[model samples]
Target: MKKYLPLIILLFAFIKTNAQYSGALPSYKLVSGNDWAKAKNYYLLTLLQQDAEAAKLLKADAGLAKLTADKIALLKSSLAECKDALCLPAKLKFTDDEINTVAERLAALCKPGSALDKLIKTHIIPSGTYFQFQTLAPAQLLEKAWRQDAAAINHTIAVYAEGAKPNYPQIDSISYNVKKRGYYTLMYDCSAEVNETVNARSLFFEPSLKGALTYLEVNERMQAGDYEPMATTVNKPAADKVKLTKWANYPYTHIVVPGAGPDDPNTPFSGEGMLRCKSAARAYFAGKAPFVVVSGGAVHPFKTKYNEAVEMKKYMIAKLHVPASVIIIEPHARHTTTNLRNDARIAFRYGISFSKPGLIVTDKYQNDFIMNMDKRCLQELGYLPYKLGKRLSDTELEFYPLVNSLQIDLDEPMDP
Candidate 1:
C-alpha cells in the first residue's frame, strides 16, 4: 500500500508539470469562417509567457499598457460603429496579410528587452504568414486561440491610426497689414517669349523698340479717342474680374519669374530688376508700409521649373536697392499651393496685419491662377481676410515668352 501511494504521488506531480508547460488551453475552439486572427495573438502571447524568456517579453510597460488600452477602446468604438462590417464572420477570416499586419503592430508595441521583442528580432516572418496557418486545417484550435486574444486585436488598429495622423498643425488664422506705404509681391509663371540679342546693346535696344511700338500703338489709339482709358483697362480696376477682386485689399506686391539664374535668359528682367521693383514699390507707397516676400524652391529631379522665390529674393536684395529687412524669402515652396500656404505662414508669424486687401503682381497669364490659388490657400489655412488686388502687371514678353520657349526642353523624354 505504501509503494502504490508513492507511485500515485509521482504521477500526479508529472501531470501538473505538463499542464504548466503547455499553458492554459485557449478559451474556445476556432470557429469556421470566423476571424480567428486576433484570437491567435492572444494564445501566442499566453504560450510565450510560459518560459522565463517569454515571460519577460509578455510584461507590458506603462507606455505599452496605456497605448494598448487606448487603442483597444478606439477599436471597440470603431468596431461598434462598423458593426455591419465587423459582425460578419466571413469578414473576419484570418488572411496572411491580416496576420502579418497584426504581427507588425505587435512588434511595434513590444519593448526592447521583452521576450516578444527577442522573437521578432530573431525571426524573419513574412508579412502574410497568417493565411498559411489556416492551411493546417486546425480551425478548432485556431478559433480557441484567437478568442483569447480578442483584446489585443482591437488595440492594434487604434494605435496605428494615432501614429499615422498628420503631424503638421492646421493653420487657424493669419493676418497681416502694411503699417506704412510698402509693397508685397506674389509672382507666377504666365507665358514666355524669346528674342535673340548679341550683346547688352542689343538686349536694351530690342526691348526698347518693342516697348516703343506698344506705347505708340496705345498713344495713337488714345489720340484717336478710339477707347476710353478706364481704370480697368489702363490699370487693374475694382471689378468682379476674379484677379482684381482677389488682390483688391492686399496691396503688397512682389514679382515671380521663371528661369535658372538671376540673369537666366528666361527671365530677362534678372535679379536686379526684382530688387529695383521692390525698392520702387516701397518708395511709391512710402508711409503706407512695405514688406517684400519671394516664394519658390529648388526643382525636383524630374521637375522643370527652377525655384523662382529663392532666385527672385536673392537678386532683389543683392543687385537691387531693396533692403533685406523688408524682404521675406520662402525657399522651400515647390508649387503654387505651397507658395500660398508657406508664404502666408511666414507673414502670420511676423505679426503682419492686413487691414486692407493685399496685392499680387505676376505675369498676365498667371494672374488668374495665382489669385485663385491664393484664395484657396487662405481658405484652407483659415486666413480668409480681404480679397487680393492686382497691384502691377509686367509685359508678357518679359516673362511669359521665355517660359513658353522652354516647355519643349523641359518635357520628359518619351519611351521609344
Candidate 2:
C-alpha cells in the first residue's frame, strides 16, 4: 500500500487538472437573413469573450478564469444555431503584455501526452507560432501561441475594414487597321425663304422647291468654286480616277432637341428640325454616292421615329431613282460613339480598307466630335490587312459655331 501511494497521488493530480479543462469554445451562430456585416459583428463579440477567458487561464488566476468562463458559457447558450464549431484554447484580449504573459504560462504547462501537447501538435506546429519560450515543451506550446496570434490578426482586421488592393493583369499593347471607305455628306435644317424656328419634329425643308433650293444653297456654300454640277465621277485633280468598287452613305441618324416629348405640348414640333436635317443629308448623299448606308433606330422606348436611314433610302429611291439594293440599313446604333464603333466594324467586315478614302456624313455641328471618334476607331484597328482613309468634308464648320452660340444663349432658361 505504501509503495502504491505515489501512483495514487499522481492519478488524483491528473484527474484534478483535467477537471478544470471542461466546456467547448463558444459556438458562433450567424443570424439568418442578416447581412455579412451584422453576422461578423456577432462573431467578433464571441471571439472577444473567448480571448478574455483564455487570458485568465494563463495567469493561474482562478477568480478571473471563473468570471470569463461564465461569460463564455452564457454566450454559447445564447447562440442561435451553429452550422459548425471549432474548439479553441481560451485567449486573453490581444495586447503585447497579455500575449507575453500567456506565452510564458503556456510554456510552463506544456508537457508530453497532455491536452496542450495534442493541441500544439495538431493545430499550432502545422500553422506557426508567435510566442517564444525555452523551458516549455515546444511540441505543446502551439495552441496558446496560436490563440495569441489569432487575436492579433482579428484586431488588425478590425482596424482596417478591408485589407490590401490586389494586383491585376496588365494589357501589353493594342493594334488597329482601316478596312474601307466611301463618299459621305451632311444634310441640314436650312430654308432659303425664311429663317425657321427649328424644333425637334419640324422638317427644316418641305419636299418641294423650297427644300430643293435650301439643299442647293448648302451645297454651293460648302463646295464654293469646287462644286460639281452633277454626281459625274471622282474628279479630285489630286488623283487619277480608279474604278469605284463600292459606295455607302452613313447618316447622323437622330436629333432630339431639348424640351420635346409627351410632356411638352408647346414644343410639339421638337424633333421636326432634326427630321428635316436628316432628310436633307439623305438627299445630298443619294446624289453623290451610288450606295448609301442609312443609320438610325427607335427614338423612345414606347415610340418610334422615322428611321433616318429608312426615310433617306425611301427619298433616294422614290425621288432620285436610286436602286433599293444600293442602300444598307444599320438600325441598331443608339449613340454617336456606338454608331462609329459599330460602323467601323461593319466597314471592316465589308472589306473597306484604308487604301480607300471613307467619308462620314453627319450634322455640320457634330462633325468634329464624330471625326475624332472615327480617328480613335481607326487607331483601335491597328496595322491590319489594308489602310483606311477618313475625310470630314460634308458638315460646314460655320454651322457648329452658330449652334454653340445658340446653346450658350439658351443655357439659363433651359436649366431644369
Candidate 3:
C-alpha cells in the first residue's frame, strides 16, 4: 500500500483534471472597483453565467452531461470570502490558503487556462486584483424571442422580482465576441428597467441616453453606408487620393490585403504586415490580379495613428510602384472578422452585381484560419464571407452573397 501512494496520487490528479465542475451558481454582484476591475469582473461573470446556463440546457445532452455536471458541482462548492457577496479583507492580503480556506474549490475553478479564464483574456491585467465565469437563458435572446415580445421579458421580471431587488438576466457587451442587431436598444431597455424597477445600476450596456431613439433617428443612420457611426473617427486617405474603378467591367479580380500592424516611422512599413503587403504587390506584378484592396484600420495598441491599408497603399505606390488607381482603401476593419465583412460591405455599397468576392491576399497562418474555421470563430464572426483554396492562399479568395448579406455584428462597442 505504501509503494502504491505515487500511483494513487497520479490517478487522483488525472480525475481532477478531467472532472467537469457542476456547481449551482447564482447571479454575482461585485462591489464595484476600478474601471479595469469592473470591466474584467463583468466579462468574467458573463462567461461563468453563460456556461452555467448552457449546462442547464444540455442536461440531457449525453456527450456534455458529464462535463456540465462536473462544472456545476465545482461552482456550488467554491471557496469565497462570503457565500453570495465576496468581500475581501480591508488590507486585501489574501494568501492561497486564506482564500481557499473560505471556500475550498473556488480558486481552482477560476484558475488561468480554465474555460472562464480564456473568455476574459480581452482585458489587460492590473496590480494582482482581478479574477474571472455563465450559461445564458433561452428567453434571453435579443432578435426573435425577447425583442419580438417585450411583454414576455417584463413578465419574467415580474415573476422573479424579489424583495424589490430581483436577480435579472444580465446583458453585458463583454459577454459576446460582437454585437448583434438590436443589441444596443435591448441593452438600453433592460438596463433602464433594472435601474427603474430594482433601483440598481444596469448590469447590461445601454447604447443611448435620454430614452430610446425615435424612428427618424434610427432611419437616418440605417440609410447611410454600413450604418456604423464610428467609421467617421477612423483616419482617411488624402482627400486627393484616387478611388478605384467600379466592380463592373473591372477586368481582373481585386487582391485583398488585410492590414497587420502600425507602420514604422524609420521604414515605410515594417513588421509581419509589411510582408503581407509585399506579398500582395508580388502577386499584382505577376498579373495574377488587376486591382488591390488594402483592408485594415488603426487596429491593436489602439490610437497609433497609422492606418494599415493606407500605409500599404503608400508602400505599394512608392516601393512596389503599383498603380495608386488600382488600390481600394477599406480603412475601418478592426479584426479579421471585420476584415472579411468590411470587404463585402464596401463592395455592395459601391456596385450591385459587378463581381462576387475579392481575392484575399494575406499571410499563411491567417489564410489557413479563413480556410479551416473552427467553432469559436464561426460563433463570434457568424459567417465566413469568402471562399478559400490553395490557389487563393496568400494570393486570392472569393466573396459570396450568403456571407456578405449578414450584417457586420459590431453594431456597437464602448469604443469605436
Q: Provide the TM-score for each candidate, comma-separated.
A: 0.30, 0.26, 0.41
Ranking by lDDT: 3, 1, 2
Q: Of 1 and 2, which scores higher on lDDT? A: 1
Over all chains combined, what TM-score does candidate 3 have?
0.41
Query: Where in model 3 is the C-alpha error above 4 Å?
Result: 1-252, 262-269, 352-357, 389-406, 410-416
Alpha-carbon shift of residue 237 in model 1 (angstroms): 35
Better of 2 and 3 by TM-score: 3
**What C-alpha lDDT do the candidate models reach, one value each?**
0.32, 0.31, 0.40
Residue by residue across 217-276, what tens digits does model 1's lDDT show? 221211111111211231112111322323334333332232222434344334443643
Model 1, CA-based lDDT: 0.32
Q: Tens-digit lDDT track for model 2 on 338-359?
A: 3443343333323232232344
For candidate 2, the clash count comes to: 32
| Model 3 agreement with the true structure over 1-416: per-residue lDDT tens digits | 99999999988855553231111111122222223211222322223334543223223333334333332232223322222211111111222332233122223333456442343232211111121111222112111211212222222222221111121122111222113444344333333332343211211211111111111122221111221321222222311121343445443456778887744433434477778888888877887655677877654443344566778878888878887766777766666766766665444433323234456778888876666663534665455545543444444555442223223232222111
Candidate number achieving the greatest TM-score relative to the actual structure = 3
